[model samples]
Target: MADEDLDIRMFVDGKGPPDIDPYFTEIEGAEAIAQSVALRCYTPKGYAPGHNIDAPNDGVFLPDFVQSTMTPHSLFTAKTLVHGEARKVDGVDSARVSVTGDQAAQRMTISVEGEGVDGEFEFSLTVDPSGLGVTST
Candidate 1:
């Protein structure tokens, strides 16, 4: 349900100082998913989203990836692990990534089908002061 997407209000809206874990986790998950998708679609040569010569033109990220688990949160990042291959075989595959989760956990299911690759990618993760990392598929 859309309610599960990312409830920033849960932590905001006069609720409290705002538990940034949810927002941070959601952002990390999104970045990871995009990276995974890019890896699936194919990233450009010397194309990196960084700051240094390799780092892209992105500004200072909310998470400077200081304690960032896998070289600054990514597909391989401990907080987000996207498994299962869903390639667009005929290049017409109706690929869809549906996300669902709560403050406790977040899950992403990627479905792709066209001609070449057909499968489902399920990524489950949880990031919080209580815990962090991909729990399951």
Candidate 2:
């Protein structure tokens, strides 16, 4: 994900108790990258929308995550990077980037918790090490 200008930015795109949209905007973004990830992701029950590069709200957003929330980070594999926003919940900043590796195996979940976020679970996404056009809907 760190080549020259490519990156996956995490942020909240929607707000409604019943629904929220997480936007994993591609820094130096690419649409094909998002398409490729859609082909591999195993969206579990309750999440069944469509994958449209131009229509982010139509699909579940995918994001590329790092091995560490700190600096000098090692990029997680595309298969493992879960892209989502880091925001405050009750003053605790938290985020979870993950993937459902195997049905039998526990979902590969990385908890990114720190200051300034209210700890709560809304919507989340995980992206692989792709290019700049991958945006999770």
Candidate 3:
């Protein structure tokens, strides 16, 4: 059996008014799990009300962390945050996260590989100071 979720867009370009739709798109299986992992990891700690409160610093602090420094420690921290969040998802059996940064472009890429009920899955997201962009699953 596969999980299903509403296909809501998390990151917006902000070029114009937000896209309004009365109907919701549905996503299923590995894609749904992957999207959940991405959203959880992308959200900053303490931002999500009543979620993961025990682990206060669970979410990625990419915007502030990457903007300030690109040190090895920071990259490791990002990886840990992402990995921890990915592992917490219900369908995930195992998860590995990698965070790489480009100092010149001030961009960071977070990649996740895992095994789930639907089988193996991979997800990646590119984030810059502007915001999160270019997600693949």
Candidate ranking under lDDT, highest first, comes to: 3, 2, 1
lDDT of 2: 0.30
Task: Mark the regions of model 2 whose C-alpha exceeds 4 Å error after superposition.
Answer: 1-83, 87-106, 117-137
Best by TM-score: 3
Score every model by TM-score: 0.23, 0.21, 0.76
lDDT (CA) per prediction: 0.28, 0.30, 0.66
In candidate 3, which residue ranges exceed 4 Å CA deviation? 2-23, 47-57
Displacement of the residue 116 alpha carbon in candidate 1, Å? 8.3
Which one wins on lDDT?
A: 3
Estimate the Cα RMSD of every predicted model relative to the unseen true structure.
16.3, 15.1, 4.0
Model 1, backbone clash pairs (residues 3+ apart or across chains), number: 5
Query: 9-89, model 2: which lDDT tens digit per residue?
Result: 322331111111245555432322333223223332234323223533222233222222322232344323334322211
Supply the TM-score for candidate 3.
Answer: 0.76
Model 1 off-target regions past 4 Å?
1-53, 57-95, 98-118
lDDT of 3 at 36: 68
Tens-digit lDDT track of model 3 for 1-137: 62343455433431111132234445556656666666665576755412555556456556665588688988888888778778877789998888899888887888888898878988776767766653546
